[model samples]
Target: NAGVTQTPKFRVLKTGQSMTLLCAQDMNHEYMYWYRQDPGMGLRLIHYSVGEGTTAKGEVPDGYNVSRLKKQNFLLGLESAAPSQTSVYFCASSYSWPPGDREGTEAFFGQGTRLTVV
Candidate 1:
């Protein structure tokens, strides 16, 4: 089973261009998140959804939006790409928040989506 899958593993976008990254999981997780990884900065949360049809802003929400229309799918959209938006994006899903030693709390991540905005 594909734990988590991200579409378009790599992409190069010009300024003002728009694109959407898709994340899908088959683990039946209830929490999903979008994060970006830059050279110096570690993972920075972009957005997250606790369940289907629910989404919330994260650390860096500007220039990006996300939606969880289905229980197993999450989409991150860039309205207008920017240079600073260039980064490796990751999608993760977990069965619980504040992950602990509890079963199913461990997050499963997708390979990753490398995005470059020029």
Candidate 2:
């Protein structure tokens, strides 16, 4: 019954280091998303996937990439981590809603992964 889980609760990186954040869910959801939150700010979408083998960019996709090779897992990668990318990242998944009818849909969120770039 693990809703969602993110690996590496915390990490520190140099200005140009590279890393990947792993997210896994057992909910069998059709939609998955990656988001980042700065101190005292709301979450900002980084990338997302609609289903297995499908991915898309979200509000703040710069410096980040994501993959959904399997239906139950999503991975977010920082090719060259930057100081500005330092933040707490979150992973979420939701059941599919009908096209053009996304009302009242909710997602389950992971605890979070904190990353710092210096």
Candidate 3:
């Protein structure tokens, strides 16, 4: 099964242009997330969905929007792309955590979507 796949592995965009990055998973997981990783800094959450039909903002939700229409897919949209948004984007999924000890959930990552803005 395709655990997780991201489209347009690499992209180039000009300022003010818009694009949408697609993410798909076949694990039937209940949690999905979109994050961006820049040099030096660790992964910063952009958006996440706990389950199908629900989406929420994360630490770095500015300039981005996400949707979880189906259980296996999550989409990240960038409107009016800017150079500051250039970074490696990753989509991840995980199984629901257990009640008390919920700190061990490991995120399964997609290869990554690299975008460059000029």
Candidate 4:
């Protein structure tokens, strides 16, 4: 099974265009998150889903939207592409880590999708 898969490993969009990046995970993690990475900065959460049919905005949810239609799929959409929005996007899934287990707190992340808007 593909643990976590992201579609269109790379993409380039002209400013004002729109596109969706898909994230699929085989593991049934209770929570799923989308994040974007810029040079020198760490991953910043964009949106997240607690379960199928539920979605919420995150730290950087401003130019983007997300939907979790199924337990295994999370979709991130860019309504209108902008140069400021260009970054490496990542999808990650995680189970609730037990309070005392350090090793179990780590999350599983997809390879990432590199997006460029100009």
Each candidate structure's TM-score, on Cα atoms with residue i matched to residue i, is 0.96, 0.91, 0.92, 0.91
Instruction: Write the residue-wise lDDT of candidate 2 on 74-102 in tens digits.
Output: 99999998999989999998887542257
Q: Could you tell me which residue pairs clash in candidate 2?
A: none
Q: What are the clashing pairs of model 4? A: none
Model 1 residue pairs with clashes: none
Candidate 4 lDDT, tens digit per residue, 1-113? 68789998999999999999999988777678999999898999999988899999899999999999898999999999999998999999876543224665457899999
Query: 38 in model 1: Cα distance from truth in Å?
Result: 0.5
> Candidate 3's residue-wise lDDT over 1-118, tens digit each?
7888999899999999999999998888889999999999999999999999999999999999889999999999999999999999999998775322466355679999999999
Measured with C-alpha atoms, the lDDT of residue 84 in candidate 4 is 99
Q: Which one wins by TM-score: 1 or 2?
A: 1
* Worst window of 10 by summed lDDT in candidate 4: 96-105
Off by over 4 Å in 3: 98-105
Runs of candidate 4 with Cα error greater than 4 angstroms are 97-105
Query: What local lDDT does model 1 show for residue 98?
Result: 74
For residues 26-104, write the lDDT of model 1, one tens digit per residue.
Answer: 9899999999998888999999999999999999999999999899999999999999999999999998887555976
How does residue 80 of candidate 4 score in lDDT?
93
